[model samples]
Target: MEAKELEAEILRLVREMAPHLLDLLGVGPITAAQVLVSWSHPGRFRSEAAFASFAGVSPIPASSGLTNRHRINRSGYRQLNRALHTVTLIRTRLDPATKIYVARRMAEGKTSRDAQRCLKRTICRQIFKILEPPNRTRAASLTDHANQLDAI
Candidate 1:
């Protein structure tokens, strides 16, 4: 059908646009596109924490009477937050490393929801990295400069 073909084309474009993001463990075509659209320029976020805040996944404090806790965030980009939730579900169910992390966090007295929030923050960091432009290391830049001078 025409709709299926259009969907396939869109997916193809998204894959071509962000192969690195697509390569991530839990990033499907739709999730990658949502992330790319939400974070058109990754540099806009000062840090991964900032990006998580923008996505509405950053933990907010909810401490009460010496008991430390946090409540679910319900602000910021709801679509981006949904995308992150989708990633968390995929990783929690299928990714072994994430499974281990969830178990470890649960052992440390965190509820599954808390553990998932932690995972979403981590996923946001990873998404930021994938979207961020690679900066040349000092040594590499120096070597490139030396090579340019030699060529000159």
Candidate 2:
């Protein structure tokens, strides 16, 4: 298999798997596929911390003999960072809450990068919230109700 042919094969497999992946995530196939693509790349994040660093959201600690400072980790996957940044930018434009949050951070004297990092963190939180599992206990209650009806 030539490199180009291998690449094509991988892409075909990804397309086939995308819908199932979306279904598992409980999201529309297109949206889930888009998220997967954004997070997928060679040499991309290997863990959440790495992804956080890549998104320029990880705080870098600096401490030296009574003087301490924190800064953004300026290393890791630039592509992922850029993707998160694009999302943040779009959110800022469309979401008034996000815009206000950014503005408030800026008013608090945060640098532009710092403000952006804040926005990125906010976006990450939202993403995680969407991807988190819902309560299964509620489903169990419905099942219990159905069982009672069956018993009657």
Candidate 3:
């Protein structure tokens, strides 16, 4: 079929660009390609948080009264968010580490949706690290920089 052929071509291209993305538990070739396209260049994002915000995986504070909770961000690149959501869904069902993480979060009183949001944020961070060029500042340094900015 033509669709199968196209998918194969896409997989080949994605493999040439960032094969490691496919090694990730929930990422298929299409999802990898989507990530590659969206994260077009190194240094495009100042920090992993910035990348996460762009992907709409950043948590927004929604705590009120006695409940401390965060909500999913409703802005940014929806296509990318959908890709991440697809990855999150796959991982939640099939990835052992992700299962453990979700269980741990649930044990800590987070709802299923909250656990998934956390996982998406974590995945965004991982993808950012992999996509970042080696010459750029690593996430720890970026986090420190963000912290310093927060202090100012």
lDDT of 2: 0.59
Model 2 over residues 1-152: C-alpha lDDT tens digits?
Answer: 59778666655655675534333222333344455566553233344455566555787887689966567767765655665666767667777877798889989888777888877766655554343333434356566767889999
Error of 3 at 80 (Å): 0.5
**Per-residue alpha-carbon lDDT of candidate 3 for residues 1-152, written as tens digits (9 for 90 to 100):** 99999999999999898888898889998999999889986667888999999999899999999988899899989989999999999998988988999999999999888899999999998898788866576565567667889999
Models ranked on lDDT? 3, 1, 2
Top candidate when judged by lDDT against the true structure: 3
Tell me the deviation in Å of residue 72 in model 2: 2.0
Could you tell which candidate, 2 or 3, scores higher by TM-score? 3
Q: TM-score of every model?
A: 0.81, 0.52, 0.86
Residues 60-93, candidate 1: write the lDDT tens digits. 9999998998866778798999999999999888
**Candidate 3 — which residues are off by over 4 angstroms?**
135-152
Model 1 misplaced regions, further than 4 Å: 135-152
Off by over 4 Å in 2: 1-34, 37-51, 63-68, 132-152
Clashing pairs in 2: none
Clashing pairs in 1: none
* Local accuracy by lDDT, each model: 0.83, 0.59, 0.90
Q: Which one wins on TM-score?
A: 3
Model 1 reaches what TM-score against the true structure? 0.81
